[model samples]
Target: MSEKFRAYLIVSVGLACLFVTSGVGYYGFAVLNTPVGDEFEWSRGLIMWAFAFFFIVRGLVAPFIGRITDRFGSKKIIICGALTAAFGHFLLSQVQNIWHFVLLYGLVGVGMSGMAIIPVSSVISIWFDEDRGRALGIATTGVGLGGFVLSPVLAGFVIPGFGWRMAYIFLGLVVLALIPLVMIGIKEKPKNYSNDKEDDFKSPDFEKNDVRGVFSNLSFWMIVVAFFLTSMSNTGILQNHVDFLTTTGGFKLQVIGASLGGVGIASTFGKLGFGWLSDKIRAKYCTLLSFIFQAVSIIILLNASTLWMVWIYALLMGLGVGGWAPLSSVLISKNFGLTSYGGIYGIVSSALCIGTGIGPLIGGYMHDLTSSYYQAFLFLLVLYAIAIPAILITTLKN
Candidate 1:
């Protein structure tokens, strides 16, 4: 097959996989939160913790997943993950206890380990070398699009009418439906494709990657730490996004869904826009711009009183969310090279999981305590500010 055609298929598979995973796993949970909490008589913090654990397990398993993908292939691993995710989501429909929710979400996390950004970016890195950022931007846009299409349906019609259990089953169906795309489209690039020499990750530095000194590098640590902080803000805000609207702004569920829908639409543009810009400029600067967008959104949320304010928050935060994702793979490839890309990227992915894992609990706890997300949002703003310096201070040389 032509590299061009194969590359297109690869990217299409990635988009579908990422889209379903984020929709059902991340944002779908957003829709399910209030309903699930109400049904189980659980506190917001208690329920959000399950999400926190999912991300934590996803991160921790990433290195192993990355290694496993390298040995066998992402195709089988991803398919298995997809199947596991479907089963886990189906079980979520039958959750009768808190322990079941926690355990089943962990199963979903295992599936995420095989499908999330690290694995998706790793595969993309092996295919499109030159427009890596742009390709990833386009592919990662699936995440936003999923939320765009699903949030409204789940929040507006499904959850309100059929209840949250059916929502999980619906998401499981979505995952199963994507399997053909995965099986047909996802395949590793040939090792020595004549057409791919100028593309793919090994083009510039066509040598085996060494991770011996990765831990001792300051810039590597900076990438880790900086993204950790960024993930805290991003993940925390995402977990409680709809709740903030309903609780603080007094918006209805469908109204909150509309705001999230806007976020999804804007995020699509943000991913493409910033991704293209990253190819033209330093990625870190573009990252800084995303940070600014998110910070402003958080501040707006703190004072959000109407639908317009909610939309404003959603748009800015969506841009930040969408833009921030592609840059991670771009930065990691640029800084660490593709030789140990999976391992290095796994560490970074885990850092993101760690940050996200903790953020929701903290955000939920804050809301539970103060009856508002204002203080937590403010703290996220501070973390964004801290990340600016953290990224800028790192010396990429070495």
Candidate 2:
């Protein structure tokens, strides 16, 4: 095969990998949140903790996963991740209690970290240099696409017809199916590509051996702070979205499922749109624009009493959050270069994971306390406001 064909193939594999990992592992969790809670008669906080634990585990392991990708290449790790995540889903089908659920979900988290942005981005960054943003945008669009399809499938068909336990098994099967795709398509970068090349992209500073200096880098921390806050805000709303609509908005399960699926579709467009736009404009400006979409969506959500208003919120929020994954990789590569891309991004992802873990818990806690999600969402908006400056001020001063 030509190098160009090989490059595009890698992107296809990356997209398929995320579609399963985030689809079954991430978005799948949100759809299951309510049924699992309702079945066990657990508090919203406890239910949210399981998700929190899942992301926290992913965060804890992200740095290691990144380093492993740096050392061993991403192909092996991606294979292992597929198996581990599928096993986690299968185990989830047999959970008899909350502890069993949380621990098993954390195991899934470990698997998902392997398949997530770090390794995928590491591989993609090596393939296309100038158009990396567009490549990443297309690859990561799988995340939203998976959610768009899977949310309704779980909500309307799988969970309702087979039950949540069967739903877990179904998700497992979906993940297991990706093994062939990974085995056939995933590959290391070209032999001509050297990760150690700092000038591969135009940045103000590139360090060949400055892995240690990454810790002291101002731009790195700003990215960390921005993503952490953004994830917390985004995840808080997402994890609680179903319950909020069910209890507060008085919507039926089918309607809620449809709305979530619509969000997924909007996010797909967001990833593609913002991803391409990032290459044309400054990634910073594109990111800022995406953030604005999310922030405004939240405002619409706060006042949403009609179904149309909620749908509007879904569209805007999808577009906003969709840009996050690709832009994150773009920003890191733009500023830090790909030499330590895995490790640097791993740490940043760790912070984002922590924020995601906290988000659901905060939303759950606020709901349990107030018997409403209003306060939790308001608090999330404040975090969004704080994150804006962190991203805005981040500059490659090195």
Top lDDT prediction, candidate number: 2
lDDT of 1 by residue, 176-246 (tens): 88778878887776557443233243223323355444666766777788889988887898778778778
Off by over 4 Å in 1: 191-208
Error of 1 at 288 (Å): 1.3
lDDT of 1 at 281: 84
Model 2: residue 31 alpha-carbon error in angstroms: 1.7
Give me the displacement of residue 114 in model 2, in angstroms.
Answer: 0.7
Give the least accurate 10-residue stretch of model 2, judged by summed lDDT: 201-210
Q: What's the lDDT for all of these models?
A: 0.81, 0.86
